[model samples]
Target: MSHDDLERAGFKDRTRVAEALETVLGAVSGHDRTDRVALGRADGRTLAETVTAPSPVPGYDRAAMDGYAVQAADTFGASDRSPAVLRESDDGAVTPDAAVRVHTGSDLPDGADAVVMIEETETVGDEIEVFDAVAEGENVGDVGEDVAEGTELYDPGHRLRPSDLGLLKSVGVDRVEVYDPPTVGVIPTGEELVQRDPAPGEVIETNGLTVSRLADRWGAVPTYRNVVDDDPNAIRAAIQRDLAKDVVVTTGGSSVGERDHTPEVVDDLGEVLVHGVALKPGHPVALGVVEGTPVIMLPGYPVACIVNAVQFLRPVLKRAGNAPVPDLPTVEAALSRKISSEPGTRTFARVRLREADDGRIAEPTRASGSGVLSSVALADGWVVVPEGREGYDAGDTVAVENWEWSA
Candidate 1:
């Protein structure tokens, strides 16, 4: 909670920050796999091991078009004024001076020059039909041209898309070994925190549900518990309930408020890797361990909670699942209006994107506060404002990270 803490932690150094992150996660032994699930159900699951293709893509030589396959040199001298004749047999057999009737996927016969397209040449019943000259080999797709056999179809950490699934099915793969998704125990801790189904003065348990949705997005099974009072023992026991799971996320009690017991509870139960992070909206983020399972303590503010969850905690769970980090999609856009922020911590604000005369512009939403949840809900993408800058203004180019781009 002091500048001295920042000095000791060296939060300004990216290498040190990354080192802190790995040290926190390295202590955790990720959850292991058990039963095998069907390919259709393996959408979010990470691949425990590599999945190889049993067969090659485009296993056969297939025609590229409805046009003709011809020996390039055969139609060399034929053109509009000087027409060439293509001989056609009663059986539609093709020869150097002849043509054959072939479908798109039909195999090429041995020692046949080419099947000149009807448009390329004018066929007068049984002539070596030609209107244009041809090269040596044209309109022919060779065997294994699309994909080579025994090549690495997908790797260990590759996430499967619909196209990837189709590729797997095309290559004769029935099943794959995928990492078992870890379970996350989310506890919303605050005396003021109330349940959706509640007593007097109780508000809906929105944070827990939000965390649950995030867990789903990050490919983890979330076991959400009811709102509990700010009691250290109660919180500790609640966390212990999901010992079988991988990571635990607890909201509230991250700051030095009177009832804040998260720090004490974490210290009593396990090691506290970091009591605070040097970031806005989530400066009180507590990275620690409880009984060896990693715990990520987040601030109670709606947008703050959401931002920290994505930029920090999600990566640990993603690695546990053996899934490659989803690319954080960024698009260069200009600011529609001016915006300001303080130095010392990075900030992410949600904004809408629109095409302007010059290029795309990011319009920052006015609803930016710890309590304003609609700001993020209405956001098309997030604008990142780094520490130590005065602010960004209209026409300033910046990278806006989108929620779903490739998806």
Candidate 2:
């Protein structure tokens, strides 16, 4: 936690929040491999190419009910009072004076076009009496009724759900070409950072776990690594080792402190597209490319780390997975108290929401500290104060992004 004189010199050129995000998003594209996966394992995987039905469903004309298939004209005038009298054909053919018995899903007789329910007919000796009539196509399932041949089942980049998998299976698709989830390496760096068990004054390393889980939720395979010390050589070596991954996320060491070596290491290895942003809690966020992999250096503070993950790492992961970037749900809520932000910095104020008679109410969880991770856990969503807006007064309606999502 020691600071050097050189660490006081901050970024000379800072990028606008929106521009920085855009630059990072534009630079990092998905690096997915297309491979065939069994239908059982295709759920949640994105389609690498469009899928088309090879053949029609119910491939043939068949019966749709458990009734006798008969020529439409044979039962035309059949009614309750005077039913049609017809004999069962010995050869199972629908002759002028004979009817054919069929069951549901059985193929209709060559000369039959409809089916008459058994309840509508009664047997008398060797002849049957018909009471009701059916149309030419009634009780019949036509070819391609469910799905036609050459129909597009799904487009490229479509994420398959369980229902989609059932549909694919129904259409005889046993395997599919899907874009494999990208592999991400999450590295946490800090000399005093420790794993789950921490000593006094040692910050337990949690960003790696949090960010890795977030990446996994976004359809990326995450590999969490041990914490690296604040030395430039150690940080650079870790980045080099993880360069084989599609994306590398280093938590902490992004600021200008002497202990912050991630930005310098990333810059020494490759181009640093963005070093600083006009954003609260995550101003020191850095976006760069190491070798061919996208490297994101998140702020050391847990709250800022999580905020950066949502605002920045999410899009990169989505693009890398070849999945659609879903729009986060937002709702307008009345502020319970005044919320303030710097003049030129975009602020993401965590708030706890409550339901009231008027509507939803948003109250800031904390006014001063961004490093308190518990405040983030207590918050239900965030009130995003855009850049250029100084603050909002109490009772003002503002848009808030909810954290929970229901399928």
* Top candidate when judged by lDDT against the true structure: 2
lDDT at 346, model 1: 65
Question: What lDDT score goes with residue 176 in model 1?
Answer: 72
User: Which tens-of-lDDT digit does each residue in 110-201 have in candidate 2?
Assistant: 78788888889998999999999788888888888889988998999898899999888877889999998888999999989987688888
Model 2: CA > 4 A from native: 1-17, 62-135, 329-345, 352-364, 385-407
Superposition error at 330 for model 1 (Å): 3.2
| Stretches > 4 Å off in candidate 1 | 1-20, 28-30, 34-38, 69-84, 89-93, 110-115, 197-201, 353-361, 366-368, 403-407
lDDT of 1 at 340: 74
Among these predictions, the greatest TM-score belongs to 1
Q: State the number of backbone clashes in model 1.
A: 19
Poorest lDDT segment (10 consecutive residues) of candidate 1: 9-18
